[model samples]
Target: MSALAAGQRTLSGHLLAWALGALAALWLGFVVVGFRTGQHEADELTDGHLASVAALLLSEATNDFADPRRVIPTSDGDNLRAHDYQQSLSVVVWDAGGHLISRTGDAPLPPFAIAEGFATLELGTPAVPWRSFARWRAPAHDRRVMVLLSVAERDDLAWDIGTQVAEPGLWGLPVVALVLGLAIRRGLRPLDALSAEVLALDVQRAAPLQPRLRHQEFEAVVRAIDTLVARYHAALAREQQLASELAHELRTPLASLSLHARLLRGKTADEAERQQSLQRIEQDALRAGQLLGQLLTLARASRTELAEAAQPFDLAALARRVVAEYAQAALDARHELVVEAPPSWGLSGHPVLMELALRNLIDNALAHTPPGTSIAVQLDAGERWLQVCDDGALAAQKPAPAPAAQGAAARHALGLGLGHRVIDKVAAVHGGRFEQRPAPAGFSTCYRISLP
Candidate 1:
């Protein structure tokens, strides 16, 4: 699976898998330890029993028989058949000369090749495979006693002991799994509720998501989400306010254009009147166009659309170019335009945005400043700052005192107009601000955009 797909799986699945895997490992370890312990215990008990039987039979032979090579009769078949354990066991005795002294119950001939101790004999058959213990009664007697038991019987006992030891855990596994599954489901209910809240959120309406989560683990995530939602709501409100303002600002020029069009259509009895009407229409159209352009610039500045057009360029050169482009307009307004900067200073940013900000500043100065006003465009290389300072009539106008209960949009509108707002936004995008203060002559306003 892809890494992303693997990561996207539920946390509960991973948790449950790990939990079950650990439990399984523990369960396997219990089974192994139980089986080994039971097997070891069975071996000790079986070997001890064989040793005791060999000792007892040797004692009986030494006491009862006068000849060391005498045979013992096992003719009482009823007594032998009554003992269940004896059916699975065999005993044999031999003399030093390899003569079989005595034997019982279909005992196989013991291999004297093995030294006196416990040993396993294959016997070349599946059913009667043997486990045997042998001992010499004493060196002087020249007799060997051998005791044998079936391997299958010992294995059966060991398996039974192991099963008894492991039975409880084996039976409890399903109950444990069920309990764990229920615990996991209960533990994840908070996350499920949080997910539902998130899914139900309405971005257009700027709705907040509030989930009653009991987990402290989700606190940070919830706080971050709430913060983002608040920011989104603020941005939406600002855009709505801007739209209302745009419509209000455009109404006057549109009404003027409409009135002039009617006048032109009426053929009002005189050439000069018709010419005046056309000029008025043209002026209103220009005003409306300028307003729309300013609004578009503001929109672009507010969003990331202009950021994609960013590139490294010489800021001083761009400033000089903008100054030159507006020089003719300054001349027509009877204003002096001056640029003070180095020949070149490198900067990385959206050049179009910088140009737009510069043009707006210069145009504002040209339109609002009296004739003979001097507008200066200054570039400071060390500070990476650009400033346009204009001595203008509008610059002389003092800001009105803010009302105590003024809303944010009202305060913003009071502080800036369409062109000024666009310039301010452009400056903000470049990590700077616009500044306006009284100059020594009349008044001075500066647009400063910090460059990187």
Candidate 2:
């Protein structure tokens, strides 16, 4: 399977597999331990019984029996056939000269090779397998004793004991598995409920999800989702505000255009009167055009795709170029336009948006302040700051700048609400911000864009 497919199992499937697998392994270990323990114990007991029989027969031979030909009967003989005693204990007593003194009817003959300790061997005419223990009587008598037990019957007893011990656990496995499956399903129900709530949520009217349970594992996820919804709500509000503000901004200049047209409607109007009305109409047209242009620039700056297109360029060179382009209009308005910068201070930003912002800042200064104003474009290499500083109208009289001054730079400073939002959008797109304050020295107002 592909790696993705292999990892696609449910959380419950993984949990159950691990839990049941571990339990099965533990169960198997117990069964194996029980089997080995029972086998070892059965061997020890049967071997002990063989040794005891040898000792008893030898004891009688030495103390009581004068003739070795007498057969010694076992405590539980043929009458105890159900106990399989005939296959269990078979004794053979012998003389030192290798003559059989006495032997059980079912007993295999003595092993020829050795006469001491426990050994497994095949003996007698047909060579039937037997487990045997041999011992010699004290040196005075010169007699040997060997006891035999059937190997097959001993194994059956050990296997039967192990089966009895393991049978209950084997039978209980299915019951245990069913209970474990139920437990795992119950444990995951909370997560399932949370998923259902998330799916049923209304994004248009998003609200914070109140945590139904105090589960630490899901707290972080819930908080993140709530934060995302909050941002979405803010974006919707911004869009609505933009539409309302744009309509209000367009109303003033359009009304002027309609009024100027009325003033020039009749043939009775003189040439000078007609000329002035036409000029004012043209000026209002320009104002309306500039507002639309600012809105367009804001829209372009807000594009997500353009944000990723940053490239290296000289900010100082860019600022000088913007000033040079606007120089003729500044000269016409009798205003001073200058750029101050280091030789070639490098920076990285989207060059198109930077140019648009510079245009807006210069345009704002020209329109808001009076003629004879000094417009200084400042660039700081070390701090990555760009500023446009302009001298406001003299303290004697606060009047509007000339027609030449009214065309371009938008002051991001206080009072021009639409212009403020335009500069803010441009600055945001550049990963920077614009601020306006009283000029430190030699100027009245200063607008600055700082990029980190």
Candidate 3:
């Protein structure tokens, strides 16, 4: 994943986890509250029913007070009502002095202060949960009857109710978590689309970003990217402008230097002075031509729209043509130039640039080698090479070696008499390198341009 996408996914994962936890905590709290409320309502209803029963019994005991023997046996008759209630209740009756006069069941009633109204209390050996209410009755003038009713249910029932209340959250939590995860992923779709669009952009073409955001959230980010791209274009244009101006400014000084040297050559009348001036004029003209050519090449090479028209052409034909064209100059310098390109040799490139590059190589070879040396241009098909060799100074003075094994250094060194700027630029434009190697006969220079 890209850095942006990975970061978004991490954020979503953490958010989903936190949301699920928070929702689960809230669901648990609601379940707990519901369970407690349900238990309170159930206990209240049971306590109210038991309280009515206690009141009815107290009335019966008061009515039968005149005949103690007819009041029913301790085990049978009217006391049987107390026995029936004893199944779920423990009853205790007391006078105003806190003395217990009537009792039913085995569990002891906790100590209670005598009061005029009802009060609830919990009881048991293992501290059983119960609801107890005391009823205060003053039937006659100064006599009072107190009845306490306590109902006990098993602890297991309370737990069962609590578990029942938590059922919904247990079943629904995973579903909510899944939904949240999907929602987070869906919400980040715009960002993913935006990243893909950005990656598709090509700096050369410099097309504008698509205005295709799915939501308003990414408006600022998209705008910022667009602004940055505009700035880059502006910067690139400025650099190109500066390069053009610098190249233009150098041309005038070069022209003036070439003109002055040429003018001085004719004015010097002495044979020695005339010869020296003529040599200086030729050297300065060559240098001026070289600098202008390099500036032009550099300007055109970087243009994106600039493209070479490539075609298949006979390598030997092209090599022979350049050698034949420069042969007269070779003859004038007392040199023997030979073309050794075979008819079967072939290569392909932009014809015009290749011609320029081959001509520069020929010029450099002729300028450096001594008179009467034979220069041969050979097209080797087996090695896919066009080799130019010279039989002068090859085993003696060689040019600088190539920077790297793959990097071919142009051998344009001519003891400061010839300029290298033109040859280097031509090689660069043709995407080739120049190298001079030691030969048994003399020095040989090769201008190797890769064919596309």
Candidate 4:
């Protein structure tokens, strides 16, 4: 594939990657939050259970607290119950005087307060830590029968949570990314197919593109490609037609010139014969010049910058001057040339280009017609339009089409090869159009140069 094709493909890939990356970031954020939340929940459950156990021991010991000896054994039993029995917890008990009486295992006791009710405490230092909940029971009527129980455990709730909480997506992330990547590739398949279609196209076969873009997001690109294909096909057809017309137009004049030159070469040519041959040569040369000029005009009209330096000008005065210049030619052909434009008629465009387009039409009509034909120039002005038209007047009104007509017209339309290039370029730059139509009597061409 070409660089442009690769760039387009890469663009789609980039977009897919970006979208997926954003989703992944959001998912990861949720996962992090979920992990933290799970740890917090585990800590709460462990603390809550320990508190319940402490509360149970406190209730049991409260009955025996009147006598120190009786309460000591029960307190020891409570400590053992929390530690030796439960594999995950440690325990300690303190008397009403804040003296440590019993302990379960070698786990250090959390630095709990001697006050009544329950309290959570962190043991060790800030650097290394363990935590526990302590329950202190001292009924209002029995100040001497006070007891304290503490349930202690190592603080690794976060680690325990990691082990217990199941993440359904833990093993599914890679799989999901792979699936999404594949889906992205599949979704963009239509673009690849469209590229291949365009690459295979040529002037001879400018087939319209019909790619299956499953996603709505890609529809605009597909439509644009299709529209481009259609325009390309139309342009190719026009080019071919122009070529045919060029050949036809040049055939008769070229043949005549060649034959006359051959005749002069064959015999001992007299001065008169030589002069006749030379005159024919000159005539043919002039015809060739005329054809070349028309082709050039058409080329100019199709150029992208055909009217870059356009300026406002009085349409009426310009028309009068053009008509005056053609007055002598019209009279020679026994035709009348008249200009009918209002003094207020004004327009904006490249004056030279506009004059060229108008002159070509008049010259073409007069050249094909006989003497005594009437031609009138008229300008119609409106709020949005400035139109110029010519009345058909002349003999031989339906002369055979010129060989260069198609070349001229096609170039004129697209500003493609030569003359049309100039016209199209100027027309585009000026934001204008060139129109030609068969006149009621002969033919008329109009150049509607818009004004700001």
**How would you encode candidate 3's per-residue C-alpha lDDT over 1-452 as one tens digit per residue?**
58777567465677777888898898778877878865665555555666676667666645323332222223443554453223345556666556555555444555656444455555667665455556655454223343334344423444455557667767777888788889988987777788888899776665678765357777878788887787668647844764565467556556656665666656556777666666655555655566566555444433411455556777677778888888777766656788876676655555565566566657766666655566777666776655567766542343433354112111233223222433444454445554444443444544444332
Runs off by more than 4 Å, candidate 4 = 1-16, 61-130, 138-154, 163-168, 188-203, 206-230, 259-277, 296-359, 362-386, 390-452
- Report the C-alpha lDDT of model 1 over 1-452, residue by residue, as the tens digit: 68987669687887888888898889878877977787788778888988998888777645333343443334344565455333356778776766666665444566776688899887744446788988877646577778887788778776777777777777777788788978998898888888888778877766667656457998887888887788778766866888888888889889999988888889554899898888778777777787788778777766653337557899888888888887776666556899999989887777788888888777766665556567898888997777777765553353432353122212222222677777776776776676663443433665666655
Can you write out model 2's per-residue Cα lDDT over 1-452, one digit (the tens) per residue?
69987779888888999999999999889878877787788778788888888888877734333344655544445564556333457777767777777676356566544759899888767776788899888765577878888788778776777677777778888789889999999999888878887888788986888757658998988898897788678767876788678788779879988988998997878999999899888777766776787677667766742346778888788888999999987786667889989999887777777888788788777666667778888888888888899876452165665554444333212223566677777677667888886686878789898887
CA RMSD, predictions in order: 9.5, 7.4, 19.4, 8.9
Candidate 4, residues 314-345, lDDT tens digits: the string is 76787788889988877655566777677767
**What are the clashing pairs of model 1?**
none
Of candidates 3 and 1, the better by lDDT: 1
Poorest stretch of ten by lDDT in candidate 4 = 141-150
Error of 1 at 247 (Å): 0.8
Q: By TM-score, how accurate is candidate 1? A: 0.62
Candidate 2 residue pairs that clash: 360-410, 362-409, 363-408, 363-409, 364-409, 364-410, 364-411
Ranking by lDDT: 2, 1, 3, 4
Clashes of each: 0, 7, 4, 32
